[model samples]
Target chain A: MLRLSNLHKRFGQVVALGGLSLHIPAGCIFGLLGPNGAGKTTTISIAVGLLAPDSGEVDLGHGGTPERAEVRRRIGVAPQAIALYDDLTARENLDFFARLYGLSGPQRRERADALLARVGLSDRADHRVKGFSGGMKRRLNLAAALLHDPPIVLLDEPTAGVDPQSRNAILEMARSLRDEGRTVVYTTHYMEEAQRLCDRVAIIDRGRVLAEGTVEQLVGTLGGSSVVTIQTDEGDTRIETADPVGELGRRLAAPGVRGVRVERPDLEAVFLHLTGRSLRD
Target chain B: MNAVLAIAIKDIRLLLRDRMGFFFSFFFPLLIAVFFGVVFRGGGGGGGAGSGIPVAVVDLDNTAESAAFAAKLIAASELEVTTGLSPTEAEEAVRIGRLRGSIVLLPGFGEARRRPFWGEPMSIELAVDPSRAALASMLEGVVTRHAFEGLSEMFADPAKMRGQVRESMDQMRRDGSLPRAMRPAFEMFFNALDSMLQTVQEDSAGEPGEAADPAQAAARAGGWQPVRVSTRAVSARPSGLPTNSFALTFPQGVIWGMMGCALGFAITLVMERTRGTLLRLRIAPLSRMQILAGKAVGCFMVTASVAATLMVIARVVFQVQPTSVIMLAAAIACSSACFVGIMMLLAAVSRTEAAGNGLGWGVLLLMAMIGGGMVPLEFMPGFIRTLSVVSPIRWSLLALEGGVFRGFSMAQMAAPCGVLLGIGGMSFAVGARLFRPD
Candidate 1:
């Protein structure tokens, strides 16, 4: 279990984290969802000891020492940036980090080879990262973060800028990590990703958590509404009327309507209704 | 050792992979080295031992005196002397770089020597290029020596003719042909004759511009000779380069190079901080110190290698050998530590890579200039020399060049090394204080 209590952080006049708190149960894929500039990064930085919160404490589970070397030794982190050395080969970069983690020569080589294979980059192991595409770099980034086999993992928008296929693979990897009993704290703006991969989700905005729970629970709590959508050739796709649910239903009932499916409010609609903003925003 | 080796290999690999950076690092230093090497070679002043001087002579006194003097110059290997040059032509040739300098003998130069100017001493005007002014006095000596040698040859026969007078005086005195009172008058006449003969005979020996014997050169020069002050340094060690000024300057090149390497890493570290890689590393069980230490070790190894490589090239390629290997190594180690500390401080203080690198370059250039990298202390204006004492480069240069030139004994060198070590320790402490991990 990882617990943050009343964490407060500031930069100049801007309050990046305003008395925020959270608890992550062990061995679960926990999603931290927020809009851009939503203190997701600030909170993660504090958790990992890269930043010092003005007034709060981060307690890593299993006797984790906050801001201590031992705590860092037990955790793997995949940052949003392409953190691997651009000039080094995938295997070389991995081995370098592995050695930093105190792995022996033979062990580092073996682990680097295994991780490259796991990331589907074994064939390109020797190619410098400069030649890698956004997706490949992200995959390698993930592999590097996992080099030490840390029991706890933190990923800050690890799938950002990645293709849909790579995103799927990465999300699946997170699931696998959770299944293998590693406590995972993942940050993203992608509601669909949180829905697909996380057991629990916390939607944060303006340095505060706005909502927290499972998908159905949150939808139900927000008084889930039904949504009707239609496709047309017209470029003007706006619903003219303020309440288009009735109009949408009547149109769906008309002749020549090929498909009609009533949709209970998904995470996107729930987010809009609860927070008065779209998930993407 | 393994950790240090890993870091060094990583640095080399990264630098090699960056095509533009690789080109700049290797080619830039090499280009500067080659350029300076050629210029110093051509300058002749940089030879540090003797001059390759070529002089033109305007011999107006062609009366065997000047002609024989000119011929003597032609015979000697050092001077490439030309004859029959007018005063203006000789000076013009020297100005145009065709000649290092020139000597113009005024008309009636030998005749003037016979009649002393107002019973006072006079000197010949040796027209010279002020650009090669360091060689002016030397040119004067060369001409004086040549003219004196010719005069010595002329006086050789006169000195031999004096022996006949001495023999006649001895025979007259032994036969008792002169009265004692008459002998006194005769002795006075002999004294007068003796004095006149000494004058004429000495005048025959070329004192060049002086109307006296060449043997009086020491007295004429005010107790010093026209000869060079040859110095074989004992404590103030002589470098391969001219002057001890270079001894205070050359080490700063290594310092600047180390600074460059350190700045490279600091910039990289700042970039990592901005991009959240540092945060990622933190989360991955790598403490702030580990990240910092890894980078520091990498930079230190890189800087030390560059410094050592330069020293080797200076020794083998330029024949600039270090007097003490241990001292050189100590200086390099201290400098490397200082570089690492400064880099860490820059990284800690900066919010972005550009700012860090910009700050680093500015500091490095400032230190280089003040520490005797741009201009040697011997050549610097007085105020600048006073200002250089505080620069880390100054201490580095003192320690390193002192080691190379044998300018300081171990006890004497301790203070410079201590100052360098102090700088390193202070910077490291400040950097650590500034370093913050959440």
Candidate 2:
């Protein structure tokens, strides 16, 4: 579990995190959803003690900040950029990070092997990371984050630029980590991912959380009722209502209806309605 | 500690995988060492037949005094003189740059030497090449030193000095060189010298003017070889050939090898930052100090290992033996520490891999050029040698040279080793203070 209270970070004239506060609870996939440049990476960075905030406190649920080495040991970070030594083999890379976490000798080797197999990279364990495909590198990067099996894992856009297969594997790994009762802090600009994977989601923009709730709860809060559009010879009639089934039945029984469409509310609609701009922008 | 060791080991493994780094750090220096070793071995052994400064000591005077002066030129461990060459031949040699210069002992040189008491000016012509402006002065100093030594040797022989004084006095009595008013003083001085010479030369008492043992005197004078000087610098400045050419060149090899390691490691630090591994490292359960210490230790280990490998190759393949193993170890440790500190400073200043590799190596190359790693300090210009004191390479080379062949004792070795450690400490402190952990 990680608790960041009133975090304020500035990069010269640019404000990276504007009085941001986030509390990622234990044993759940807690998603920090935002558009690009929404302080997601900065929040993760501060949470892992990689960058100190200008002002505010980061509590790792251990009565101390991640600035302390022992507190950092309880958390794992998968940075947005693929952080790996290109010259080292996958096994060597894992073994190295494993050793940093205090694994040694046979234990180091075994952990590295297990992680390699877990990421579906056991066949290429001896191959240098330099020769790996982008998707393969993404998988290896995730494995490296899980090398030490820490209590909490912070994954910063783990599936960015990965192939579909690697994306599936990474998503599955995140699910497995959650199933093992490990707290997962996932940061990304992808709205659908948060809707599908996260138990609780917070939409952040300009370094401040706009909304925090379950996906259905967020959509219900601001997404409004589903829009029922009925196209007839006269024209199309649009209606916003909670009872879509009864409305659709009445529309079907009515005079000539050329076409019909039910636009259900989702996170995209919730983001657009809340931010007045598309999430991709 | 475990994390630190892991980082250090990882860096070393990466370096080994880089072909260019591996070659420059190991095989390139080895090539330089082996090539220079073979060349110096053939010529630098204690003034072997043709060692030292190559020049022609043409005796135009052809007298016993001039010949003895020429022999002194050959006796000096600094010059390698060719006696039989005519003035024309020597001049041509200088014109073509085959020799450094030529010194002609003209006609009146012997007469001037025989009657030095009369203030007779010696005739000499030192035809130094135009390109070598300092050559004239350097040769003159060497030749004049030998001439002054001859004068001193004449004085040491009371009888010979007395003979010269009497001849000068007779000439002065017949000629108007001495004024009439000063005639008595000059005669009195000459007569007093003759009397002292007679008493001292005839005295059997072994005090004051006792006869020197011929064998001991010859040994002290370094055995008059009339045409060449031997390598005495091999035994730390006092006659003999360098027994191993590798001894003369391996120190230079270590210097270049250290440069490669320093620049390579510096670039690696920058690369890690640029590639974002530094972020991962910082996020890991390791402090900034531990991370930096790991880097410094890695560079130090690699630098020291390269030096040790070069020395081992020198001993095994080139038949070179260290003067003292303990002193050699001390030199390597201090020098490696200094370069590791330098690597830290370079890494702190470099924001990218290109800057670390290009700018850092450029700085090191300049240091090597000024510090006698690129060329012998003796042959370097005066300004360069003066600037060399600031370059760590100068101290590294000096320490290594002392260990390899300079035969420096522990007490003698303290200065260079101390300076090396001092540089290492200062650079590391400054680098660590300036390093950015982002």
lDDT of 1: 0.68
Tens digit of per-residue lDDT, candidate 2, span B292-323? 99898899999999999999998888877777
Question: What proportion of true contacts does candidate 2 retain?
Answer: 0.85
- Stretches off by above 4 angstroms in model 1 are A227-259, B1-9, B19-27, B30-34, B42-252, B435-438
Q: Quote the RMSD, in angstroms, for model 1.
A: 14.1
- Residue range with the least summed lDDT across 10 consecutive positions in model 1 chain B: B223-232
lDDT for predicted candidate 2 compared with the true structure: 0.81
Worst-scoring 10-residue span by lDDT in model 2 chain A: A61-70
Which docking category, incorrect, acceptable, medium or high, applies to candidate 1? acceptable
Query: Using alpha carbons, what is the TM-score of model 1?
Result: 0.71
lDDT of each candidate versus the true structure? 0.68, 0.81
What tens-digit string does per-residue lDDT give for candidate 1 at B15-98? 666665554444454445445544444242221223335567667765655465566667765566666778777765553334
